[model samples]
Target: MWYEILPSAGIILTFMTIPGFAMYGLNKLVLGNGYRRNMDLRFNRMMYQRDMRLTGDPYKQNGLNAVDG
Candidate 1:
């Protein structure tokens, strides 16, 4: 009973995830290099800010003070 349902559920999940993955890959492929570079830069900055906050680095400030500077 349960065994019969597992393959169908797996196939359904695969179908659902593949299109979104393909669209993401296609966007990256079609948008060229500049967009990708900008995205990478933004991601790095976000990660750095998060790390700084976690480590309580005063020099790596947050909030309006950081942006105002």
Candidate 2:
């Protein structure tokens, strides 16, 4: 019983760790510093100020749409 359970547990752990490490590597390659900052902003882990550089209709933050306003 112990032998069967241990192998199954090890295989499950391997599957889980592989993807976690892969995603960590991908995020390191792609996102660099921005990911942490984005996560922090999302979770309210840090305070942020508006960049105020954008110029457009303030209410139209989303992409272009066909709906009549």
Candidate 3:
């Protein structure tokens, strides 16, 4: 009896999880690369600002304070 129930339980779980997994899988397949690139650029810019702050140099190469004397 217990062995018979295991097969039904697997089918029920498949019904529950398969649709959700499919949706996320398709979403990642479609949008994952563009989203990753956008996030990478944002992270790099954040790190650049943080490093400049830690170094006490508020002037980037293009900073207003770095303008010609």
Candidate 4:
């Protein structure tokens, strides 16, 4: 009876552990990619805003003159 229970217990433990590890790995992968994508989006948006500021004529018409002013 003890020997039979040992096999069943091992199977149960294996099933539980394997899925837990798989889910952890998948979670890490998704989060890392999402972070990278977000950073890229932020960078692109900043660049676009900078370009718009540099090329726009409103500041010239308003006589702001300086890029930082």
Candidate 5:
């Protein structure tokens, strides 16, 4: 039983992890440097503004209005 289960588990694990790695690779290829730069900018902004008010809109602090008032 263990012998039979091993192959099945291997196949299941292969199928599960392959697509994730493939998609991650695909995103890296597509987004390239821009994704990392944007993430770094956002991280730095958030780290510097630790005491800023939290709003429902993410772009609020970036000087973009979420709603017209």
Candidate 6:
């Protein structure tokens, strides 16, 4: 019983880790890109903020078009 449960637990843990790893890679990419281009961290942050604001509203923004399935 314990041996069977261990495999399931490992699989569950792997699923959680995959997302976490992907997010870490994405964060590194965004910051890394700005760094290589000589842009300051503040500038990078501002750009991300602007994009979020532009896409935040489900009605006024592109949120609806983004989820067409």
Q: Which predicted model would earn the best lDDT?
A: 1
> What tens-digit string does per-residue lDDT give for candidate 1 at 1-69?
779999999999999999877866885687532233233688777876665566555234356655433
Task: Choose 1 or 2, whichever is better by TM-score.
Answer: 2
Instruction: Select the stronger candidate by TM-score from 2 and 3.
Output: 2
Quality of model 3 by C-alpha lDDT: 0.61
lDDT of 4 by residue, 40-69 (tens): 587776755565587652212233454554
Q: Report the error of model 4 at residue 25, Å.
A: 0.6
Query: By TM-score, who's the top model here?
Result: 2
Supply candidate 6's per-residue lDDT for 23.
67
What is the C-alpha local distance difference test score of each model? 0.63, 0.50, 0.61, 0.58, 0.57, 0.60
Query: Model 4 — TM-score against the truth?
Result: 0.40
lDDT (tens digit, per residue) of candidate 5 on 3-54: 9899889999999999777876776787552222233687777744542344
Better of 1 and 6 by TM-score: 1
- lDDT of candidate 6 at residue 45, scale 0 to 100: 65
Give the better candidate number (1 or 4) by lDDT. 1
Model 2 alpha-carbon miss at residue 23, Å: 1.8
lDDT (10s digit) by residue, model 3, range 1-69? 669899999999999999877876775687552222223588777866664565544233344554446
Candidate 4 vs candidate 5: which has greater TM-score?
Answer: 5
| Candidate 2 clashing pairs, residues 3+ apart or interchain | none
What local lDDT does model 4 show for residue 31?
Answer: 54
Reference-based lDDT, residue 6, model 4: 93
The residue pairs that clash in candidate 1, if any, are none
lDDT at position 8, candidate 6 = 88
